[model samples]
Target: MEVSTSKELQAFGETSIEKIIEELREECEIEKHLPGGGYLHMSDELPYLVIYRNEDEDIEKGMDRATVRLILSEASFLIIGNKDFEGYQRLMFCLSEAMSSKFKSFLIIEVFAGDPESRKFKIKGPAGKLSTTIKVLQEQLDDVDSGYRALQLGETEVQDTLQRQPEGKKPLLDLPQLKDSGCLLLGVEVPPVYRSKEGEDYPVFFRSFKDDFVVALHKTIFHFIRIQTSSGVKSYRALGQKHLQEKVKEIDRQLAEIETSYEFLWLVSPANIRHIKDTFFETNYEQVLNYHYRLLPFDPDVLKRRLYNLKLEDVDDPALSYIFREKREELDLQISMLSERGSDSFFYNSMMLFGKISNDLQREAETILKEVNEKEDQDFKSIMKAEDFKILANREFDYFREQDKNFSSKVHVREDVNILMVSRGELYLPSDYKLNANETHALIQHEIGTHVLTYYNGQQQPLKLLSIGLTDYDTLQEGLAVLSEYLVGGLTANRMRTLAGRVVAASARMHGADFQEIFRLLNKDYNFTPQRAFNITSRIMQGGGFTKDISYLKGLVQLKKHLEEGGELAPLLSGKFALEHMPIINELKERRVLTPVKLTPRYLKSEETRKKLGKIREGIPLSQLINA
Candidate 1:
């Protein structure tokens, strides 16, 4: 037997019937039972259905037979045996009633079989009996039930003619039925005319009804087709366009205007170094008490205004909502930190967000420092001046431009420039500062590889959130920066120690340890150089306890775990993003709302560095790599 002869039939696929059979197995019992004189047994299970085939079929002719038995578990036991010419009428009625109860919905069963031109069809409803004339009046009347009844007389006349007609000459009603069956249409398609109309289509309905004796088999399959057609009119409204991208961009633009990075960076050191040194030497007490901390010229009100005015609710997507909400909270916390700069409350709250240094990390720092002090002093002295660093910056930018012609960022050097700062599109460096080869490479990777790369990649996207930075972006970005240091073979022991010391000092500062107390603890206990001790203490003591420094080490530990778990690096390079925003970024990419990254870091683009990444496979601990 041919399974299908048309596109519609082919769509049902070879497994469609098998799948329906499988479902029947789950919902009921199906088997080949004894045909001649098997006793009917009552099942305790309600609505038990069993389908079987008779063994009485002729072995010589090789003909197969199919039969179905339905047991209404709750109602009376129903035994339907196969019938001859009735053609599954008894089975269809039982199947319709069973399905109606199963689905808990009213159902209308229609059956069609044989050839397209000379097929036989039947219609039956589980509950309400549809007027036979419904098909005829469906064309002329709007009220479908009224139409069905209006044409009932015509249906009777047609049925009489159909009965008198010869085999293969009966009229086929392949017309359109009521729009919404609300009641199921088993296998029949009510036609517009009494035959298939040109260019007119009907939904394929699949259902079966059979008794135990006869296999009422009508192979009416279902097909599904997806067509992408556009209405000729240009004014058609698009769907799923919630303007989420635009709202995110607006908020991001406002954040960029704030430039929280530079705003938070203390213009003046809070700790009075001279006073602390003088007081330390003059005081008889072990702890120095006279050092004064200063706050920078910053107004938290402006940031509060921008943050408060943002309508994050306007964002429709849940992922975008989460991203924006986090950004708002982060901004709020930052503004609060800046607002309370130089107070005990500042350090306490700062530690709340960025965790305090654990005792193990502090002890590990001491052990690593001891190992470093034992080695022959190989101190890195700066060979290049600020002018040299500027030249190097320009050269690096030039190299990036070579890789991506669109790559452009300003490299600036000024006398008043505080430690390196990248803002808007410019890289700022202190005029007197210098960097050695290793430090230069690490700095290049930290600032340019991770920071600059994400900045430019963000610009390429429609959303400014990428460039403005996501909530807690500093942790991930800094983590990637330090990892880049290790990958480039530049993360030194001293740098690692300084990171550890910052954590220790943050804890000390939170506990009300004065600048001199923190400095002395690092210098005497940890054996850090006076300069290193001063720098670490000053960082914690600055801005009334800036917690941002803790992210470098925190990010390193977190990112190490991320990479160990086989997280991809290319996605992080797409923008100035936090690890948590990865899902949203991936979603936008899949939707084609965000474009492919236009600028990747030079290190990532290189085949050599990509291979070097294997060396740091599971990632070495900071203590293990300190001296190395």
Candidate 2:
């Protein structure tokens, strides 16, 4: 091994800085399995280094910068001032030497800082096959040299000359344009312009951009499209502008039909929810358990196969691929979970599917609601009948539709609905249920503003999966729903307590607590009304301990944290989606795989509502909210 340093290095351009950063990113990404049964971490936190065990102690953030030691048994390493060049080099050298003497293939040449005339440099290598680090560094160094020459000739002059060239003489593409195109074009050949989809043979040009790479870029873009000799340059196509639009339309059409065939919640829910009210009120737990679910109206296997046949792998766009693949898996899980709904098979299956409520969450709920006022406010005491709710819902629905004529979802009261449910563009409410002003506002935001708005926005997209939903959409969907309630100032302590109660009930059921036992706990210990306790208990105990209700508070916690961390709520409103899918959603938007949001929840438009949301950025944990 050899190492060298320079007192003065060349000034690097933005591209060089970016490439050097990229090299660091790649270097830090390496995860080596330790002999001590752990892995090294290139943590994103400051100091840019960490160590983590395979099963535990994988603390990801907030590592101490002062620490500078490697513990083999503990699987940790600390290096100070990792962001700086000397520190980075020393860290890497320390890391490499500390790992094992047997490992020797290491090389790194880096430019840390300074202008073109005077920059710092460090180089170390075995003088054999050049590693990726060395290659990127060398390329950057070459760019600096080229940059110096260009500066002498005046970069503006060269650029102006290039711009003044005739249309035929113009370069096929620019670097920024290539990056935005989302196609891997480095070293690889591509057609200058994607004119047709037809196949034809065309001659190809191979060029070496040894120096003056930017100048050579123009000639390389158009001539290198032909790779295989058999196919013409036009055969290797980027998504044409017209073709992308058409593809989006096709995806939209395909997704629109999913909800019709798969009514996810309705299918998975016990068909007897409406009729079981009396039985639940009467405390007939055994009788309730004996009640059968309605037979699945649609074929599960056929639906799974249909979702599978979506060919998400063929999408060619990473964002689109991720969206479709997740939708397919989500639909598949819904189908499989539905197969066990309302039967003894449901409970364990649900645990497997959605996981049991954690003790910490239950504890948090208890702490959060311990002091909340459960009484209805006198000023908002007037309750609206189910008919009244329908009027309000219709008005909200009309306003929603007015945003887009294509928004055709409607609202109505149904004898069978337990409270409120939105499915396939229809908002259903229980026939006899009445809501006070608070409840009315909460329901509108939760159902119409959130569920309905996302549905239509998703429908408007080329990819219907937004309408169909990604896997684990419930967590983010419910989180955003609960978040909407908070935004509208309807997320009261009592409402939050109810959510916490559901988690406690779900937790109790998961631990094998019986219905009456769970109900008793909620009613007596949790201070819930007998009716409210029974409702919470029955929801968790039904369909063999359905745990979806836990999302209310848990989702709130997650969403609140997301917002506090500067997450945007508008992207979430783009469709029925999840928190983890934000990256894919943003990526798709960047690539224009998905369109910009057209519909926003009405409450989100309010300055007061936004202020409420902003205040919650510090986070309104169930305990904090209840106390507030």
Candidate 3:
């Protein structure tokens, strides 16, 4: 069986059915533009054929674009605008016949506009013959409909005539003509909820069913293929657009190019954190301290102008366009935040980039705080100096280098960095960095095992954007990093409480608590030592009340929920992306747009870690994760 086909058309510019047949003979994927606004896209020579008749509804208006997205993603032959024009029916018949003969079994689904109310998906075909396929389609479509009203699908024999009629249009190909070619054709009427139909607005039902509407269409096609066709596709994602337009590729390249121009977090980070901390301590925590930031490389206004110039309208794939659009929006916000640094607006922008603390999250933080502090007096662990830790970090890098010769990871010790961080593949450590025994292992897993490993994994993918990261990916990044700490059997109670304390600090700051007040809350109330409390308070207070520290616990909570829901942990490590982007990630993987991860963290291979992973998958809570 042919598993792949080239997009470079053998027919060149010919739109004739004879030329189309010659091209389809090889089962090669071909796309052609017809004379009268018609289009034909075949992902490969699959038995599934999807037809969209463009009559009264223009492609610009409602579900037409979404229908196009649906067609491009599926392994089907899509013929648009052909049913309305004269002489095109012959092409549909010939093409359908050729494909049916090639595959031995074929299925055709023609999507038309349905009534605005009562039925969301209305099927028209031989009710008895297509019963199984229709039943599966109905079940999936029903799952698609949600909210106040339910739109169930039913079959009508009346609309099942061999020939289709459109208002003021040439007659569509009859069933006998299609039978000469050997294919089962079905017509599906979709409610034009996405369109407002000229003047009269659609009812409130449109709003209810529009969410994930295109995805629902995708599910319908996937089910029909499984139930009635010869295609062996196992996932709805196999129906996604395999060939991306050049415009989409250019936009992805441009966005990633802009992203590589500067690192956002490094800009927001203070250049004089240690100096400021010393001055604050010398004043006995009475003085209101001011923070300083690293100088930016590019003009913020110029960057904003460059970002807004990206034409999201040109990219047709909704999924790809959304990813690019989201990244552009995030970059704009980060640029603005950098420009507004040392002001109240900076704090607000930071909160927007990384979300603020929720009541439930704050409560979870409090619970962990209460549980951990009830034990014996807290004491710092036997610490390792920054110089010694750098040697160990390099040793870890060497191990990875041995596995993949091209792996070029490095470790650097500098007073300029905050504790330890990996940026652009190089791990940085503060000159005065110190770590306890348990922390020594935990930090390695958190940084090298998770962050650096994913960085290189993303590097192997075709889309360089994955290497940089998707927008708002920090939540999952931190969550996966923290989880790695546990997987390696190095998660200490003190570390868990410290994470909880960070959340408390964020919640307190959002509620208008000053630095001194928050420090005292952690130091005196939560029993964290003064120096430790100062570190926590300082993180939340940096860059004029930054609240990103809240993400540590928030990411942990989100990750736990994902694992319990049967979400795969391996995909999260595939690249830096949020937990919510799982569907998008899986879809891309099915489309062959993403490569397999280059390296698996050592912790994931351990028999001991596998036991801990089982509990996490079974829905263990965050505070109890330390014990796992």
Q: Which candidate has the top score in TM-score?
A: 3
Kindly report the root-mean-square deviation of model 1 from the true structure over all alpha carbons. 22.3
Per-model TM-score, in order, reads 0.57, 0.61, 0.84
Q: Report the alpha-carbon TM-score of model 2 versus the true structure.
A: 0.61
TM-score of 1: 0.57
Ranking by lDDT: 3, 2, 1
Runs with alpha carbons beyond 4 Å of true place in candidate 3: 1-28, 33-38, 52-91, 101-103, 112-124, 132-158, 188-213, 373-382, 617-621
What is the C-alpha lDDT profile of model 3 across 1-628, one tens digit per residue?
A: 2333333333323355677767655556666665345667675535666777664345445335544443454445555552245445666776777766766556777766655453456666666666766666666566654432433444332354544433244445676766687777776666665546553544333333443555665676677667656767778776766666667777778878888888777877788888878887899877756788888889989988888898875554557767887899888988888888888898888888998788888899999998775334336556777887878788788878877889998888887887688886678888888877667888988999888988888888866678788888888899999988888877878888889999998888878888899998998899987677888998888877788787788998988888788777777898888777778888888877676777887777678877887898887777787776
- Ten-residue region with minimum lDDT total, candidate 1: 218-227
Misplaced by over 4 Å in model 2 are 1-259, 283-289, 376-381, 624-628
Per residue, candidate 2 scores C-alpha lDDT tens digits across 315-361 of 43334444555556555656776776756667776776565677677
Q: Return the lDDT, model 2, position 195.
A: 16
For model 3 the TM-score comes to 0.84
Candidate 1 lDDT over 1-628, as tens digits, reads 1111111112222253344334443634222111222112211112222222222334323211111111111111222222221222233233434443443322222222223443223332211333333332222222222333433322211121212112342211111222221223322222222224242222111111111101111001001000111112111111112123345667667766655444555343444555554555466324444435445455678768877888764443445556767777777776777667667677666766566766665565555555555222345454566777777778778877886898889878866544676765468787767657677777787888778878888888877778868877878888888878866767777777777777777767767888778888888887877767766776777656766777887777767677777888878888887787776677666434577887666677666566555544556556775434
